[model samples]
Target: MPVPAPPAALDDSPSARRREQRGWYFYDWANSAFYTTIISVFLGPYLIPVAKTASCAQDFPGMASDRCVADFDKLVAANPGLGYVDVLGADIRPVAYFGLITTVAVLLQIVFLPIVGALADHTGRKKELLGGFAYVGALAAMALFFVEGDRYLLGGVLFIVANLAYGSSVVVYDSFLPQISSPQERDDVSSRGWAIGYLGGGLLLALNLVLYLQHESLGLTESMAVRICMMSAGLWWATFTIIPLLRLRNRPVPAHETTALRSVGGSFRQLGRTLADLRRFPLTLLFLVAYLVYNDGVQTVIGNSAAFASEALKLEQEVQIIAILMVQFVAFFGALALGRLARNFGTKRTVLASLVVWTAIVVAALFVAEGQALQFFLMAFVIAIVLGGTQALSRSLFSQVIPKGREAEYFSLLQISDKGSAFIGSLTVTIALQLTNSYRIAIVSMVIFFVIGFVLLALTNLPKAIRAAGNEVPDRI
Candidate 1:
């Protein structure tokens, strides 16, 4: 297929760029509903119960006639090896299914995102690709509403599709950072995007929380209410994505390169070249490593905090929900506040400072007594303060070092580091849990990731990295 030239760039006036930035922010708003509602609040809790039902039927055939009436906890406790569904003769634990599916999605992205980025850079269809992936992901997420009874396998498949699309859309979206904003404006722009995303995601989550809490009064089954909330995220994602699709403009790829590297096969070859080219930018590569390590710690904490609250702290489900809501709302202001800090203190220093806070938070987790809701909330509050800032700054900083004309390709690699490292922290926690039989020790062990990442990041010379990538260094960076 012939790769057509992209549409002209948006007007270069300050107002025009501001308009583009506003539109770009909406993509963050649109997609975050998926992260907050489905991934963060609902899916694991909902899907695991569904998987448990399937596992009950498969492992305890007697319960099949009763619709799996056995108490899941008691059954698992008694059997110690129950609640597993066979996947091609492999016993897959019900609780592990979500992580398994997530791992699969990340692995797929690792293999394919670079190609997607290469294609976007070559064809300059970033806006189209962003909208396409967002809508596809929304549809996949919406399909979760139908995951009734023992449809855990169906849920897994849909989640993989949704997650893969979500990650791809984000790569394309982040590529727009360098395109739409000058180096000086990136920190503020990226932070605003994250802030708005928090507000959007938090608003939906608040509504969902109400729906979930009052399901009985609302004449809806708890499962059905959860399903509706999940579906609503998809609807919200699809609805808001239209803003960016309408407002964002695509920059044309150079004519000679567009004609020469138009094919999917050609994009793959370009990806190969990009991989080989990474050696030319060691500082950029080192920053990615630093990000991968620290961000893994961040992701692990976010991913496992609920489990920690439930298992180690013995917090109620309601308390956990409230804490998550706090994080969501507080993070909105936190992102903006951090952006301003980055403006004054520099993005690298601000992120490093956030890492220090993260390490402190994990350490503090060790001191929260079991069943102490207030103490747990205090820790969560601290986490919320730094969560958005660290991630937003990291995104903006990475944008600085990416090679010109290869924004999408490099951001694709960043996306890999972003999504691909969660398992590492999880594994570390798992190992710690196995050895110590203490969730506190396991949670605290994540401090290592932050320490290592902070050390590496502190050593990285940002101006050098930027210049090494043949890009101009921003004054603050």
Candidate 2:
């Protein structure tokens, strides 16, 4: 295939753009609630106290087994490196307890996402997987209402399930971008999805924030308010998700006449063949490597920043919520602006710019210390600026390199690749914090991933990949 004239192939008509944007937006709106409610704002903070109590059974089983805190107290009295305990004097750290639960969840996704990708392509059950995972994740989130005291273990269990669903569903949702849009138009479509997701996640988080801060004022206990927020997120995920399933057309799965076991076996075998395509799909491979590294940094920020701020800097909960609220809206517009930039300057340039901004933010973070709410809040705006832009543009750029009809499967492998990179950022934070006991330094170190990703991304042959993928057209020289 010859290099495509992206302008002509993109179908820049208002009608085409509108349809692509709408679908993209709806999907984001449906999924953002999980990131906002369960992973970031609500669950982590709420789980901290409970995990301390639960960890006693495992961490100090010889002493704390009876009342859950007896041995914990003894260990503390003996001054045994017990910093993991909370203000109420309860265990959470070496375990990263909640993180451990979700780490297991991501591992499930690393294996499961790729298989589901193959299944979605072979079976044409893309939306089914999307809807199914959305509800399952939601239900697991709602069940979080039951997590209390020693129930932290249960919370961990539910988190694994909920996150697994969320991860699996995203693979399919991301895959749909390339399938539904022409090669050139995918960025616009992907951007709309990201913008809408940010808005949706923001909206629910905003309401949940109000509910959280004013639980007693609203005639609800803090625990109940937390539960209600968790439940609402699930319902929100379930309800809004129906829109795409109803409106979108389903493509039938490939009609390969093979046994089910053999078909499954073949997808695994073909994994190696897919690797071969990587060398040919140079930009796609480079972009994947870039995304793997940068997204690790991004996910680390999203997943751990609040905890770092709260635990290390000793930030008030209200301040964190407000900053997160600001991030949501800022991200919504940031994604929109970045998407427009991609349309004008191409995906690589725009995404690289976002990465540059992220590098600056992390570098600036090194100087932010103590309970500097005002400083962190200011930094939050910078975070919001690049947050949506990098993710949306990366998705769109990768979408251009993928062929049609393999969205779910390809994106599944992409998700797996992405999750695999997370270990790097997670390890970076862990090693730094363990060695230096410095969350501040750990937070600053993530910037290296962003900088390196941006430089590597600049060198990728994206135009060549587009041409090889049969997505390119002739130039009108």
Candidate 3:
């Protein structure tokens, strides 16, 4: 992409910009409930019992079926259950399956994100695009209410569709950042959005946690409570989205096509041009590569944490839920604090510090023994502090390095590549678990990604990249 002319910067009055930023914050607030309740806290654990029931367990004594399933009742007649049972000749663990399901979902993002991005840039209807994808994903998440006993496949399919929609919606949502705020204000605005997301997600998760813990007393079965939690996330996501949909304005491109097919074709041509132009922005490309590697580690830790706690640490589901709730509230402050830190430190340096913390997190997770709830909770606390900081800062930093006219296109690449990178991390963990039967060893692979990302980010020439992309480099604290 030849460096596009720097567009006139956003010159909104202070109050108007603040209003737009608040609206942007709500989209994060809306979608994160689904991410927290479904992806992070509940779904992985819920799927295990369902998959176990669906497995060939009832036929265990009658005959050796093709896919072996340990009869939970017979194996643990005295205890609650064996942690896992065999399926398809492999000892099926929820963590392993969760990883596979997440991997598939991220892979789907790689296919659709570019097209979504192109359409957003060409059509100038990003708000509508965001809502379209978000609501579809919400519907998919709502359908998870029907994923009952012996329906693991249905759960997996719903998760994939929901996750794909979630990721695609984020691509459009992130592009709005540059439009709402100038480069100088992006870190603060971006961090605020993430903080709001944590609050929203945490608030809803807290309510669902109470519902889940007191299910019997409330005249609801545990399974039914979990189903209701999943359905609630979809409702929460769809409802809050109305704020941003009503407030955000589309950034118009000059002479953009009107027809859908022409718009798509134009998007493809622009995408090709953008790829060729990448070579001119070496620092941006380097940062993308670094983000691709490190974000994978970040995502794997997040995606697998609840499952790891339940399966490896043997924590109760309530304990896992509470721990995640703590993470959400803590991360809310963490993102705000990091935004201030980025003001004092440079964005690159602040993000690199978070990566160091991330590396230590995985290293520490390896030493945490099974059934060590306190140790695991402490580790989760440390993860919470860095999790939002790293992700929020990375998004702000990447926004500064993309060309003026193509925020959506570049952010689409970021969103897709972020998920695309997860494929390897998730696959590595899954394969390691299947082969070695040790999550501790499986998690160590993430350290390599963080270390490499830190080194590359440290070496990146941010000032030059910002200038090359026709963006002003924001001042460091």
Clash counts for the predictions, in order = 0, 8, 2
Model 1 residue 268 distance off true place after TM-score fit, in angstroms: 0.9
Cα deviation in Å at residue 67, candidate 1?
A: 11
lDDT of 2 at 374: 92
Q: How does model 3 fare in lDDT?
A: 0.83
Question: Candidate 1, which ten residues in sequence have the lowest lDDT sum?
Answer: 64-73
In model 2, the runs with Cα more than 4 Å from the true position are 1-21, 55-78, 81-95, 257-263, 269-272, 417-421, 435-437, 473-477
Could you estimate the TM-score for every candidate?
0.92, 0.86, 0.91
> In candidate 3, residue 342 scores what lDDT?
91
Tens-place lDDT per residue, model 2, 131-234, is 88878888887888888766776787888888888888788777777656665566667777788888898999899888889888889977788888888888
Predicted structure with the largest TM-score when compared to the true one: 1
Ranking by TM-score: 1, 3, 2
Query: 1 or 3: which has the higher TM-score?
Result: 1
**Across residues 302-411, which tens digit of lDDT does each residue of candidate 1 receive?**
86677677657867766877888889999999999999999898899999999999999999988999999999889989999999999999999999998888999999
Q: List the residue pairs that clash in candidate 1.
A: none
